[model samples]
Target: MSTDVLIVGAGPTGLALGIDLARRGVDALVVERAGELFPGSRGKGIQPRTMEVFDDLGVLDAIHAAGGGYPVGMIWQDGQRVGEHRMFDPVEPTEDSPYDAPWMVPQWRTQRILFDRLEELDGKVAFGLEAVGLEQDEDGVTVRLATGGSVRARYVVAADGGRSAVRRSLGIGMTGETVDPNPTLVADARITGLDRDNWHIFPPRGEGDGFLAVCPLAGTEDFQVTAQFPEGSSVDLSLEGVRKVVAARSHLAPEDVTEVRWASDFRPRAALADRFRDGRVFLAGDAAHIHSPAGGQGLNTSVQDAYNLGWKLGAVLRDGVDEALLETYEEERRPIAADMLGLSTSVHRGEVRRGEATRQLGLGYRESSLTAETRQAPATLRAGDRAPDGTLGGVRLFDAFRGPHWTLLAVGAEAPELPGSVRVIRGPAQESYGKGLFLVRPDGYVGWAGDTADGLPRYLARAGL
Candidate 1:
C-alpha cells in the first residue's frame, strides 16, 4: 500500500497523529503489532496541557465525561485511616488556563477515545501488522511487515513503545539510567473492601518490605493496584499472587480482590533516543524517550510529540510547505522530553513534589529556531510562549484557535488583512496579551509577536501562511 504517512503502533501518539492528519486531509495509516488496544490503567494521569491538546483535537468533551479528578491520598496504618495526603498541589482554574489540574483516565480508555476520534475522521489502523524492516531514500520510505506485506509512504513515524522495533531497526542508541532497581507490579482488579473516595496507601512495615497503593480507577469499577518490591526481587502477576500481596500489605482480606483484569510488571527507568529522526522515518513517544511513571509524564509527553509533529507533517504533505519544517520537530520536542524525563525521575526519587512543574502548561519553544520574537520589548506572553485562553472581542480564544489553521490575535491593536486561511481575532487590550499582534501557530504557540503588522507579511510567507 502507498500513503502519505505510515505510523507504527496504535497507542495515543499514533492515534492522535492519525486524527490530526485526517483533519488536515492528509492520507495516513497506523499499524499496530498487537491485535487489540492496550488493556491496562498504566498511564492514568492526563496533564492539563495535554487536556488543551485534546480540546483542539475534538476529544476533550468525551475525555471529561470518561474521567474524574484525582482524589486525595488516604494513608492507612494498622487497618486505620491515619492522615490525608494531597497527591498534587491544588491549583484553581482560571480563564487564562482552563485545565488547571490533571484528570484521571486510564491509558486504555484514553487510547480508545483517540481511536474512536480517528475513525470518525475517516482514518484507519491496521492491527497485527508489525514493521519488521524499513528502507528510506530521498523521496519516501518502504516498510516491510512481518505479515508478508509492505507499505510505501512519504514518511514513517515510530510510535512503538520503549523497546521500539523501528528505533532498533534504524540503529539508534538510547542513553538512560535506571531510576529505580526495584521491580513494580501494576494491576487492574475489582475489589470489594475499598471505597472509591480516596487513593489508599500502605507504607512498608519493615526494612525489606515495599510500599503498596490502591487507587480507584475513575469512570470504572476497577481499582488499580501498585506495589513496589525490593531490588532483584521478581514480581508475580498471577491473580493469587495479587491477592496475597493485597492481603499482606493492607487491611483488606485476600478475597477482597475478586477479579484481576489486567496486570504487568516493570522497573522504573528514564531513557532518551540520541535522535528523533532517521531519514524519512521519525521516532515519537516511547520510541524516542522513556520515562518513569511517577509524574505521569511518559504518555503526556508522548501525546504532545504526536501533536507537535501532526501539523508539521500536514503542512509538508498537504500544504506543500518546505521539508525543512520537519527538522524542527526534534529541535523543539527533544529538549522538552529530556526536561520531562528529569521531572519524572525527581518525582520518583522524592526530590520534587507533584506541583506546577507536573502540569506542563509552562513548556514552550522559546529557544527554537522557528520562533520569531520581533517586539522590542516582549511581555510575559511573548513569541514562543503558549497562547493563553480568554475572551477577546466576545470571541473565545480557544474557539478561534480550534481548527487546523493559524490565528492572528490583534489585542488592543488594529487588525491586518490576511489570507482567507488564517483566522483573525481582534479585541481591546487584554491583561494577558497586553498590546500586540500575536501570530498563533496551528499548534497553539505564539509564532511571532510585534507591536504592529510591520514584519507580518514576511513571517507569514516564511510560515507558508
Candidate 2:
C-alpha cells in the first residue's frame, strides 16, 4: 500500500522510469490499467538518442537483438515497384555519436524488454489497477485505485496516455490543436505478396480516398499498415475493413492480409499539458505532451522524460539531495517537449525531413540552471551539451557512465579529488570534446565545464556531492 514513487501506466515512459528507478534502488511501483502491455506497433521508431539511453539502461543488447535498421521506402503505382525513397538522411556513425540511425522495434516489444529489465532489477508493476483519484499533501500522495485499493507514495508520476486519468484527477489542462483533421488507421498485420525489404507506399487513386503505406516491421514477420481517411470519416479497424482498404488502394488482394494482429485509429494531434507538476505529483510522456507520429519523436521524447526525472528522483529520495533539483525536470524538459511537438507537426505537414534534428542528439539544456560553463570560449561540447562518447584512459566513456553516477571527464587536464559517488575518467584530448574538465550528469549531459577544478567542488556541493 506504500511506495516511494508510484507510476501510472506501463507504456514505454512508465516502464523506462521504472527501470531507471529500480536500478537506482528506488522503491517504485508501476500500475497499468490494461491487463497486458500495449499490443500494437505504434511508435516503433527508436531515435539514436534513445538508443544511447537504452545502452546505459542495460537493454541495448536486447534491443539490438530484437530490432533492425529501417529499410528504404519503396514507392508503388498500379501494383508495380516504381522508385525508392529514403525516409531519413544518411549519417555515418562516429566515435562521438555511435547510433546515427533510427532503429525499428515494435513498441510492444520495447515495453516487454523494459518490463523484463525492470523485473530483473526487482521492480513491480500491477496491471488492471487504475488510479481513479489522487490526493497529495506535503508528505506524499494517496491514490485511489479502481480495484478498491489505495497506494501511498512520496511522489506520483502520470505516464498514462494523452487522456491521462491521473492528469485529469489533478485538474490539469492541455492546450493544443489537431495536427490533421483526417483519421488514420494504423495496424499490425501478417500479409503475403510483399517483400519485407522495403516500405511499400500506395498513393491515393482518387481525391475521396487517402494514402496507404505498408511498412515491413523489422525483426518480425509482420507489416505495419497505415491508411489515411478523409476528414470526418470514421476508420474501420476490423480485419475485413483492413483487407478492403488494402485491396482498394494497392494491388494486394483481400486475403493477402491474412491476420490483423492489432489495430487502432486516431487523428493526429499535438497537445502539451498546462503544467507538468502539481505539488508531489508529476505528468510525463503523453500525460505531459502529445505528438503526431511523423518524425518518431513521441515515444523517444517520453522515454527521455523518464530518464530525466529518474535521476532527480533518485537523488532526492535515495541520496538526500534538495527537492529543488526536481524542479529542473519541468524547466528543462518542457521546452524540449514543446520544440519536439513543433518538429513532429512540421514533419507531419511535409515541411521537414527526418534528418539530424529528428535524431535528438543535438538537444541539450544549455540554459538550464544546473549548467555551469566556466570556460571563456566554449567549444562544440559545451557545459550544457550531451557528453560525447569516446575512448578515454583505455576505457569507453559510456562504460564509465553506465551506472547511476556522475562522470568527470578530465580530458587533457589534471584530475582533482572528487566524491566517491562521481566517477572520474582521465584521458588525452579527443576531437569531439576539446581539452577540458567536463562534468557529465547522471543522464549523460555535460553539467559543468571548466579549465580546472576551481569551480568543480562548488558545483558538486550544489548537487549534494
TM-score (all chains, Cα) for each model: 0.99, 0.99
| Cα RMSD, model 2 | 0.7
Clashes of each: 0, 0
lDDT of 2 by residue, 1-465 (tens): 999999999999999999999999999999999999999999999999999999999999999989899999999999898899999878999998999999999998999999999999999999999999988889999999998899999999999999999999999999999999999999999999999989999989987989999999988899999999999987889999999999999999999999999999999999999999999998999999999999999999999999999999999999999999999999999999999999999999999999999999999999999999998887878988888888998989889999899999999999899988989999998888889899999999999999988998889999999
- Which clashing pairs does model 2 show? none
lDDT of 1 at 183: 97
Give one digit per residue, the lDDT tens place, for model 1 in 186-255: 9999999888999999999889999999999999999999999999988889999999999999999999
Judged by whole-model lDDT over C-alpha atoms, candidate 1 comes out at 0.95
- Which lDDT values do the candidates have, in the order given? 0.95, 0.95
